[model samples]
Target: MTTTISYEQAKAYYEQWGVNVDLALKQLNQIPISIHCWQGDDISGFETIKSELSGGIDVTGNYPGKARNGDELRSDLEKALSLIPGKHRVNLHAIYAETNGQFVDRDEILPEHFAKWVDWAKQNGLGLDFNPTLFSHEKANDGLTLSHPDEHIRQFWIDHCIASRKIGEYFGKELGTPCLTNIWIPDGYKDIPSDRLTPRVRLKESLDTIFEYKTDEKYNIDAVESKLFGLGSESYVVGSHEFYLSYAQQNNKLCLLDTGHFHPTETISNKISTMLLFNEKVALHVSRPVRWDSDHVVILDDELKEIALEIVRNNAIERVLIGLDFFDASINRIAAWIIGTRNMIKALLYALLIPHNYLKELQEQGNFTERLALIEEFKTYPFGAIWDHYCEISNVPIREKWLQEVQIYEKDILSKR
Candidate 1:
């Protein structure tokens, strides 16, 4: 645990640099990061017959204690939320429908399938974000949806997307917060295809159909996500970043940028400023990518800092919707959740404590030399002390102390399962 005197001294040190630790904590508390539900169960929802993990989605570990049902998933989420400091929202995919033993296909899914989730979120005082499960279905056997050649198959996915939005609206109305219903379809091909334009045209038309219904944005907001490539769709992905960027701009909808969905060399931080410049709202799916779209646990690395810095420095924190989209079944699920969520909060707080305007002034005046020096200097500016203080204020365990709780939970709760 961080000592009180040490934290106070660190606060005093930052105070000399004109960074308000109190203000940083207040800003960090206000941001609600949506935690993805798929993390608890490796994207395996409570279906009587399990669906094959297809559509460019695959989890590579046989880690024990994976949630077997909706009840277990919710219980795991509760454990995770207890360890994480701030109140956050829960992100759910349509596949996580609690159908109560009755099998519900993707297209035929209704709001009632998610009634239990809504109630759970309501009771927990956490907002809900939804995503249409466009993968891992019989209809997605060809690794294409919405952009599929057959009209019947495309219509089936369109109906599923429509149903998902309605469910999102229901969740929003019930929870009294606008549910962000994000659509991400893994429609692509492995080998090179001759006619790429036709699939894209089909995809555009299908998206148009999905957005035809005018659901009140107050209840539910729509966001379309893009992918550069995937496990199977390596050669060509239909919903490329360019496609969704253009679609989002033309249709006045929010664009979702998943950190793991882009090229390994390209970070999502660079796009934050550009997206906020063009759109009224932008959404994010924060995940660590290991060479490919391998959903690794998020760490407090330079990419995460850059991402948080862009949002905080540009004054677009409120306009940007932050959500974690990681699925690592290799470790304890609860620990993974706590670690990622805490790291995300820490990154945001680190960004909040920075004197961005002061640095921007140096850049604007063409003082690059001093700007570079101060950038390195600010990195060592008592962030750890401020972080411990923030954790103390938030009433969660400080640093590795949280891990002890996770270990206890694993022994008592997870081991029993």
Candidate 2:
């Protein structure tokens, strides 16, 4: 059937359930997903003095045509953005600073170092987010940065985070969108620690120092990311979830919940509503975890849909900050971004198309049988048709047609790289 016919048929089915298909499409268009720049280069930022990949973060598969420099990364990102529907933001790390081949350490990075990124963001009409690189450095070789025992090393990381917030502020000021400056440190112990309290104490102190050097909240919003465990830090992660959640509440900062940072059974979908209740705004690093905290490409799985449903049903779409955070070097990097981001948007669209109010009424009225039946029946609904129409209207390729574009780019651009 033609796309228009399928979409028309699908609209009638949704309207029967009191779903406003057009409103859903309009709302989905306005939600911006912050795409991570590290995906383009396997988190290998454009730092002159490169360090080994540490902090339990690992990107496997040396896929050919991975971005080699800042210009190449931006070029690749532009291509990905072209394929993705709706306006989006790009998240950057402190190590992506362009310093003319000068060995500027993390602590020394300044907003001026990222002036080019700001200019590029302006040109692309994209907002920018920031992260302070806390791993893969001499200071964090022990897998302890902000919580390092050495006061000097701790101070260095603190300075870097402070500097990163300023850069985030610069991005917001230049692009007219507040930057989400998040700090994710791979600080933990490889095995059972005789002392966990001391390290967390130091971490808390370091964060206090960093947050003390505040930037305007109107321009830059600070966030603290917690991890469960990493490659080396299997037993203890200094920045535990409880730690950051409480810290965010007390300090009025944002808590960044990485989907992969929690245990396998723990889902971020369940935590969203709880976080929403306490914090004015919560941040998310949406990712898929296979067995462990592996940064796998996101798929439109049950959890992803439930996450979108929670955000939409609770009317917390604007309050929750959503960002993509997965890096897979095995397949085409651009394809990875396209697939992950498209799935995220698709999940949001799916949630928007659902008759959430009716479902809630069913639950509230204890109509469990009907609720289950309706929910299951909607799974077979013409969601794909609505999605295709959305892509058609948004001027992006519908369905697997986008794969051809990726293949063409791979052959024409990526193969040559």
Candidate 3:
């Protein structure tokens, strides 16, 4: 039976569910949260909230400058790193090359700048998460193709992979943890299919080169396979489940699934199951998906709320790395970061409160149908009241603060109108 309920109906059902909102809050108080840095504004400013929530942060993607060469980037990162709670650690994004863009000359990167990155990371007691710019294409310029057909293009990829490996080796040899080289190839088809399978094959070959380099160096690499649904008919790498899984297995590489990459076309629970099946070879990129756009919004929607909670319930939280891949030119950077992190943590609280027993039962005896029903039941569950109760108990004093912030935001938006 297709059980459909309106938002009000769902909220009402949640209110009636024998769900002790207070107890739920108490339960949520026990879990910790983490935020991705690109979506966050000022890392140092988040110190107060991070301490209150006992959460960590992941400094990744296009945030100010976490590059290997920029002196100002190093200073900014150092300042941000110092602000994190002693108990909660920070993860640094090492590379800065933009995807689907021009090739970055490796020689332009000063080796001294890279060595300085290693020094800062080691001194701060922080961890490293690497995202190398492997794909070389023109930005704002569509109809770009991988350069493998061009000798210069082939050399670019090779040299990029080699430089990335050297960086990883530096981390492994000095820091004791191999840099988690996160891979996301922007290579894809943009027009009529010339050679559908050729790009995929070439992309895999490029990945294999990196994999071989990492293997030889004995570095622990996590190949973050990503997907984009036909940007104007050009097929992108890591576009499908089968493609990702097959490539990972064939290359003996681990997989990183971006939650936002999947749409309504694929069930979130099914994706979770895939991760569980490939638990040994899988890590997750946690973010919210909205229809076709990888909105990178905070995970606040009911469907994703339930799926995220279920994954944590099944003991898969550690295997997942929380990241907010959000980008919007409208909001000031700091405000956007604060709101995004707040929303993510709030969503995480809801996930953590799902009764362990319910999850365990589904795991042992429930079929897909039964499990889905349980999820729906939880989705309709009232969580705002529970969050309020937690605020009271934890003495966070932020319920009304957030409400006021929302009001101001609304006023600002209306003023623009």
The CA lDDT of each predicted structure is 0.91, 0.92, 0.49
Mark the 10 consecutive residues where model 1 has the least summed lDDT.
Answer: 1-10
Tens digits of lDDT, candidate 1, 1-417: 556788889888777768887787888898999999999999998766677989888887777888988899999999899888888999999989988898888888899999999999999999999999988888898899999999999999999999999999999999999999999999999999898899999999999999998788999999999999998899999999999999999998999999999888999999899888889989999999998998899999999999999999999989999999888888998888988989999899889988888889999999999899988987888788778877787788887888898788888888888
**Alpha-carbon runs more than 4 Å astray in model 3:** 1-37, 40-104, 107-111, 115-125, 135-147, 172-178, 215-219, 230-240, 359-397, 400-417
What TM-score, computed on C-alpha atoms, does each candidate reach?
Answer: 0.98, 0.98, 0.65
Pick by lDDT: 2 or 3, better one? 2
Q: Write the per-residue lDDT of candidate 2 for residues 273-354, one digit (tens) a residue.
A: 9889888888999999997889899999999999999999999989989999999999999999999999999999988988
| Cα RMSD (angstroms) for every candidate in the order listed | 1.1, 1.0, 10.3
Of candidate 2, the 10-residue stretch with the lowest lDDT total is: 1-10
TM-score of 2: 0.98
What ranges in model 2 sit over 4 Å off?
none
- In lDDT terms, how accurate is model 1? 0.91
lDDT of 2: 0.92
lDDT, candidate 1, at 344: 92
Query: Distance (Å) between predicted and true CA of 43, model 3?
Result: 16
